[model samples]
Target: MVPSDGTAGRPLRESIRDKLRERIIEGTYGPGDRIVERDVAADFGVSRLPVREALRMLDTEGFVEMLATRGVIVKKLSRRDVLELFDVREALEGLAFRRAAERLTKRDATHLGALRSKARKALEAADGPALHGFNEEFHDTVNRLARNDLLASILEPLEGRLHWIFRQNDRPDQLWREHEELLAAIVDRDGDRAADLAVAHVRVNRDRVLSHLFGDHPEGTAAAG
Candidate 1:
């Protein structure tokens, strides 16, 4: 939750936006679900104005679509959307992993390890939602360590979207193992290996999600099945 600074209007709108975004991410508001401004306002005990403003912000962020007939609904992901997200992420995160490896420090290592430990516990408990948040955090921490403002700026908007996609992950343990391997390479300052692992990990999750969405074959790429 975005803790309010005991203010109103803009901050309230932003807080509502964050709460709405979190709902969308955690599957409370699934894709194509119509969002009513008045309903949201009633739920939050606020006026419809802030909810309207919050929905407008989400619309610009590509999280929701405003339709004249249907009002505002969560944006549904297509096969192309999934493919494009992973493609862009692989390209950008490759750079992040390498740069983070170059700048890895003892404190960074400790923090990454701590997150991994928590994520592992989440996995053991079969907590899909908790695991999803921690997974995103691991990637975000690596990007922060990279010290690339431009890259992070480009990625910031994509963060919620990517979390939405990755929540479809079926092999959480396998993905966590890959994360651990990448973390090891970064701490060891093996930039080349770390970058390669990061790209491969993205590809692996992409395939898993697509496979789940499309059946045994992902993106219909099987030639001789």
Candidate 2:
């Protein structure tokens, strides 16, 4: 079965868009690669209209670019783009962890505990894709525990690109360890420690991504965040 995309009843356009999005995220369709509509249509066994609509959604979400002359292609992330995104994430995520630590309900903690267990099992099983999804869910669960609607709304727009970065992580064990540390702080109800750990997590991931993309460049040049 094709997995549910959480798109509220699996509208055909959303389903197609999500499949294309997953391909792009997992590097099956890479940066700057053209996604021919007819080819995607054939692959999905559908007509071109849904493919076009899905491309439009992906375009708006900053996943791919729609072009009149060249068709659709995956969007490439500039170094500056990645760095600035991490900057925003550092601020927002730090706050989310702090608030969540301070205000965690028993139910919220239970949900987080379940997610943590699942993520750890996925890590142990060497399930890369499952761990990638769990990475996003981890952050989003913390944000939800924060119980701030304004913050949730702000974080919503950046989630797709953030998920893209999470998909870029080649070191899930390290990522899992970092998340475990942060989760530990939250469970201990140490708001300040949780906030510090969150900032450190974002910074290290930022450096890792920069190093991967631009090759051992120093702090200020490529990572100007």
Candidate 3:
């Protein structure tokens, strides 16, 4: 998350980009919604130049389309896109977890324990923001412990996409339990168990999300509508 104010006293363009990108990801600016550079500039109380730059960054990140006549519109993820992203996520995260389990230190284990504790507290409190933040931190820390920056880089965007989906159908208690189970495997240095747990965790969530989105759930029952 980029801060709004940079060290130089002006609003950082990266901050504006982050805010806008989040909106796009969370569907605040839904598919086919035209994003006017001037309007975003006014909304952020910044200049059009910075807004354009932000839009460019978003385009590069595959979050928006620079249309022929419409300028910029929010990019929509098709069902295929969602499936593909999560498929890649499952495999990559599995590999990361296995690597992490094989190499986890006492310090890494302790840090993960603390994160799990915080995640459980957030679940008990039903604090959505805290749960989301802690869950993200837990996954990111696992990626870091895997000692593969390339894997971390690849997972970053996929994690962002997956977060809102998880935030939808995932009960806080279930999330806490899954985190703890996964952590237990990693801390035990059970590489195969950790990898299996990681893949199962993601796959279960993926199925739940897909069901909520397209199956026997009530209309619009999953995401924050």
Candidate 4:
């Protein structure tokens, strides 16, 4: 029988890097937090070289910054950085929405509906993690249904940045409402409308993040609780 324990096969450096990357993405290490190689090596029962390899890998992925004098630190996104991330999201996702609408199939519609239902339940139950996962599924489904590999490839990285920023603020019910409306537009085969809605949806999120981070709202009442 193949050993199920992760200790037997791959090099320790790759294993450590994967584990550290997962933790960083899951918010285990918050912005500007210092990662001590010796400490992590002791905690994981590995040598410091593997831990150092993991930290360097994280730096390449934009999750950590290696300071000349301060070792490795988790990256913190500034207000401008958040906006730039959303801009990338809008461009790629807008293309996805347009193409998905242009060629949406019955199966695609069915899958989208199922995703919407799941997202609705997650929202009602106030399940933040489940809701975020569902939201990603919905968008990824649309991109796949679009039959555009290049667009999907571009979206993959931006999706991670979106989650990183969105998780910093509270989930808003309006987000689900907007998703439903966007899905409805796509289902109706209105490519132009769907494309517009897709861009607006991303813009609204960017606005929300900016508001949460910098106290700038777009002429609206306070978000309902």
Better structure of 1 and 2 per TM-score: 1
Candidate of highest TM-score: 1
TM-scores, all models, native as reference:
0.90, 0.87, 0.80, 0.80
Most accurate candidate by lDDT: 2
Q: Model 3 — which ten-residue stretch has the worst lDDT?
A: 216-225
Ranking by lDDT: 2, 1, 3, 4
lDDT of 3 at 189: 95
lDDT of 3 at 4: 45
* Candidate 1 residue spans exceeding 4 A from truth: 1-10, 219-225
Total residue pair clashes for candidate 2 = 0
- What 10-residue stretch in candidate 4 is worst by lDDT? 1-10
What's the CA error at residue 119 for candidate 2, in Å? 2.5
> lDDT (0-100) at residue 200 of candidate 3?
90
lDDT of 2 by residue, 1-225 (tens): 233332567777888888898888889999999999899888887777878988999999889987778878999988778888888998899899999999987888788899899998998899877888888888888888888999999998788788898877688778888999998888888999999999989988887877777664546545353
| Model 4 lDDT per residue over 111-214, tens place | 88888888888888988777766666677678887898777777665655566765655565666778888899889988899899999888888778777866
Residue pair clashes in candidate 2: none
Output the lDDT of residue 79, model 4: 65
Write the residue-wise lDDT of candidate 3 on 36-140 in tens digits.
988887787777777888788888877788989889998765556556666787879899999999999999988988887788778878887677667767777
lDDT of 4: 0.75
Question: Ten consecutive residues with minimal summed lDDT in candidate 2?
Answer: 1-10
Evaluate model 1: give its TM-score: 0.90
lDDT of each residue in 1-225, candidate 1, tens digit only: 333431454478888888899899888998899999878877888878778989999998778999999999999877777788888988999999999999988999899888988998998898866777787788889989999899999998888788778777876666777888998899899999999999888877888888876563654632222
